[model samples]
Target: MTRLSHSKHNSLDEKDYIETLSQKRNTSKSRKVLEVKSAALAAAKQHGLNPWSKDSLILYMCCFTSFLCSCANGYDSSVMTAINIMPFYQTRFTSGVVGSTTGIIFSVYTIGGLTSPWIAGPITDRFGRRRGMLIGAIVICIGSAVISSSNTKGQFISGRFILGFGVSILTCAAPSYIVEVSPPQWRGRMTGLYNCGYFGGSIPAAAITLGTQKIKSDLSWRLPLIFQCVPAFVVICIVWFMPESPRWLLANKHDEEAHAFITRYHGGGDPSHPVVELEWHDFKEGIATDGADKRWYDYSELYKTTSSRWRFLMVVFMSIFGQFSGNGLGYFNTQIYAAVGYSNYKQFVLNLCSSIVSCIGALCGVAVADRLPRRTVLIAGTFASAVFLAINGALSARWASMPSDAKNLSVGQGAVAAYFLFNIVYSFAYTPLQAVYPVECLQTNARAKGMAMYGVIVNVFGFINQFAGPIALKNIQYNYVFIFVGWDCIETIIWYFFAVETMGKTLEELDEVFTSSYPPRAQIRKVVAIKDDGHVDLVKEA
Candidate 1:
């Protein structure tokens, strides 16, 4: 036996050491990860993750960058809501053309998101999470510049498409980077932080634009759109200093590097310790034994392998639910307000208030995510969101029928209150859940690819709903659209019953759940099951 020296005055006494050692042995034997990498590979791994154990400030900073990326995504998606209130769009296009124009703008961004899963997955696999982030920031900055300079709708839409492309790329890369770098105990909170920043970004998108509501110049909307470059610039400047995913290095056959990262990440300590070595061993063996070029992760394998299949279903369902449950409404909220007899300035204020409340909700959600089981929080939040939508839908329907009397001012106030309530619930529920859900559900091998597919689904539905909003608000009542989507709230029930908790569990533990018997209710109930295979079946009983 080799006697090792450790830092004195440590928490890990003799009993802790022996117990940790036993736990490591059991986990490694079960996980089947014990492998090696070349000398350079080992050195590269050591340089990055070596100084911090558990949670590093750098890890949090990296998460904050991810938060900014998500904020950019949220801000751009909703910035147009304020633009819709502007005379620029209204005077330029007819009522019939307005919906189509907005849809085109919304749809083009989705195209950018669609391209990233295919493009980003390979690069992140080959390069690293930090490089992927750096590239995304550069792309986002250029896109913001183009959008700011656009005089015509064509140029404007083109810039939006480019921005979407960058957002889509980060969607897959950021959370994947966070999960790999985060301690298991704190992963949920760290991941939730991105969503906090996401909605926080919405504040300036709404409030700043609303604050400039009095600005009659074309620069009003452009100012908000261009501000996106500020965060992009900041993220690009700081991201270079952030650590690359140690797991990513090990996956590329850099084990010694991985150990070095582990040492620095946890502070200088015995590298041979079970917990430290186990992560390295697992990363190496998992990549090597995967029996494919780690660079090209096949989506088809996501459904073929039991672990991958489970992740695929979770990502698919969550994405669908994310879009269906009024996320699109948030995108076009100003339009919804305009249709309800509010003036343009008032509509801007309403959107600002909603964003403000949502920002607060996102912060609270971050606090809650790691404390409870991931599924429980998701289930509760989804259910509460459904209830909020139901209330909002019912109020809108009644408001449509009510006569235009001064007495109805109270009802208008109530509608505004309900709308903000919906935003609050949505931020606490779907917003963070969408980010963390994919991270929690997928393992490292197919994680990026799976999230991209999820992003694709979300935008597909998003494009449809965005197109539908202006048309519905222009033709039918806003109430009808809310009612229609209020029904989609049932997906929450499916999620509550089917989605597994992955809060503190390891990837290997999560993998086992999908292999064991438990088909989501939709499959059992004969609802649509979109599978590559013709038939849908439950997992085998354990």
Candidate 2:
């Protein structure tokens, strides 16, 4: 009995010692986590900034030029709504084939869109971001001049294609450039500002098209197309005034340039301070672990791993979802109005109202995107858009089968209301998603490549959406388009399930968040440390 008691005591002592050691280990981990959290918060706070800072203001000014450049995107999509109803395009360009020619004119731009990302992404990564912007601006200006001078359909198509190439480069380059150079706290807001400029561009484009409907000159349609060149010219002139992406410079091993840029924007700072070194360390470590110079951007990398595969799939679907939301289909709203027995002048006025609502929606989205979690805003906006589209479809179905007498006043009102409501919601969601989500989910090394792939998917779907709009209208009634779009509510459900919230995450944090749930999660780790002077350093565990 004495021996047994002695053995039990020894066992209990062993258990106690083991428990104490476990507690110490856990305590150490907890302390480290706390330290990391505090450091990250301090650094973010230290680097916090306003969107109107001198550098940011310059970016915003460039955004305005980009905004004007973006008008061509909206104009290319929607200009045909009015032009199709015009006598010139109908009789001359289409050979009286309004539907087919209209689709061709709109869809041809996607040809350039498909090729632009591949060319732009690698080049932007190699050359400076400003150079890409400058080239795109110059090309677009030349294309616009060509557009203004074109008399034949072939010439018009070629000019539009060239213009699209320029727009694609600008679209892919500008936001990423803005986000990369911006302070983390204000990155979303600045990118949002870029989006706001884009929609603002649309408002004037639509207004000009409506304003010109009264003119009898051949310039009526051509002038709007030519007017797109104005922004390109502005962008070219402003390109010299803008700062290049500091992050891109760092990535290119331009350490001196990168430090100068960060100091210029971050206030009084020693360029070689510990904080700056920390930031550089974090950036370099992230690139090394995340796979830069990895087979020189192999396309197979997208599908080789589960995480990458999922990312590619998500971005592709997101791009397709954005296009399929039926916002672009509204480009053919004039046809819908005409089919409903409305006159051209009335449709023009109606489109202008829709444009105004879209602008308001885009601005609201820019405001809310920064305020709310990105995924939530996107989901809510998509849901709202789906609801509006459903209502429009119901209204269309009701009117399509209604007697001629009841259709006159009520159908027009319903159509206009549906168009207005949908634009407002879609714009709010679209403008930000286009800017924030892609940039947020990606890190710097793969950011350009990831976004390049995203751009490709967007243009692919955009091409299909633009091409299908006319065929769908020709084969079926106008109501079918809204019905098709309303079905995208299903996508809202998909988005909620798969989408990650990214409202206020740092670039490094975002990189971690993306890998958070992947297999071997413990194998992939993120380490970010900030020195007292506000330089940030990060490392990723392999």
Candidate 3:
């Protein structure tokens, strides 16, 4: 293991950096901070370290353990969707999975999610990211066991609550670990891929349920519940061997370990690599020893500064918008298909097909995540989703009223097609960004707590969505779709006005953008670096 050297030149650089920050703090007027080329990206390019390189591959494998957190979450969602459609499950449960009873069953999971953030934030910050993940995985396995063997409504709901609690912990810790460990050059795609793992779990769960729906007994639903633990178990087995976040190590005073991890994984075993040096400087500057993460109870740092508040606002926005967008309908997609006159067999098949389409859409999002501007994707994709949702609602309103024998096959098929299209667009837009954007907006000191806050807001809205979706669908029928249609339009406007571009900048570099008088404008400023003197100038364009 190699250690970073504190030479005189580096000392002078640190002094200059601190003084610059102090000056920025004292000044009331806005000024342009020097924005250099991303040193990590430049270093990787200079060293010719491709994605397939030994070091890069190893880093990706380590990151894969975190991806399982998302997989577990995805499996739970898709499996529940399948279970809701199963006649056996409906028969076994006391309430029979309809109306208000259905709402409670779905909402209990998010209710458990609401309880996790208090402990999740502290655990991830205090015990380290790997520990948080491991604990969550173990809890998920326990929850799965409880749910699979459940004999009554209370037992089933308790199991779901436990599952939600465990998933929340993983959600809080895993993204923070991925963003901190990933090199800036690959950060977008890597973190995007983290959420993309949702489809990895969804595909299997959907497929399994499709096959299991043929079973004549309780095992049809119980078997799917049991399978939910597989990804969590995989995470438990492998997470211990993965490297700790370098940012976390440095913040915790494990400086040598931080350096060695960065060297071996990010710098390709070259301690003196520019990526390592730059990363060390940035992590030191960005992470505070006495920041909110170090304190067990103080959350003030998340809202203390204008930048911090802006970051919090973005986190809140993504959390609410991500859940409220008609994707919540996914959990009850079987109900939606039934409303449009699809048979039970057809509903399960469509559910499976929808999961496959969503998986493909998520992969497409991953491919373009690094290439496209974040703001562009959010606005356009959201609007497109709203359009498709409106079409689905219109079709359902027309065709859902007729008797099953009198239903128009073409109109019913169109409604299903529109619903599928809506999922594809939603997956393409929000799926990749949901995990990536929130973490990118947050500073390292506030990351764990902010993400915990994110978990709270997500579950809060998710609870509403899960609890109300069935009731609304039952009473208002197709009218439930317009609520999301209207909200999604509002979401598009919010993203247009407030969303800051994070493309092509290092996490430390984002500090400048967020702290500026107007972050959206600051994000649009073109930064040009002078190779001769290693100085950079920000040219205002937008």
Model 3 agreement with the true structure over 217-299: per-residue lDDT tens digits: 99999999999999999998888778899888888988889889887877778775656666776676677877778887989
114-203 per-residue lDDT for model 2 (tens digits): 877887776666676677777777878888888768789899888878877887787767767777776655667667767666555566
TM-scores for the candidates: 0.82, 0.83, 0.91
Estimate candidate 2's alpha-carbon lDDT, on a 0 to 1 scale: 0.65
- Residue runs of model 1 more than 4 Å from their true location after superposition: 1-55, 92-98, 267-274, 289-297, 482-486, 519-542
Model 1: how far residue 49 lies from native, Å: 14
Query: Tell me, what's the RMSD of every candidate?
Result: 10.2, 9.4, 5.7
Deviation of model 1 at 394, angstroms: 1.7
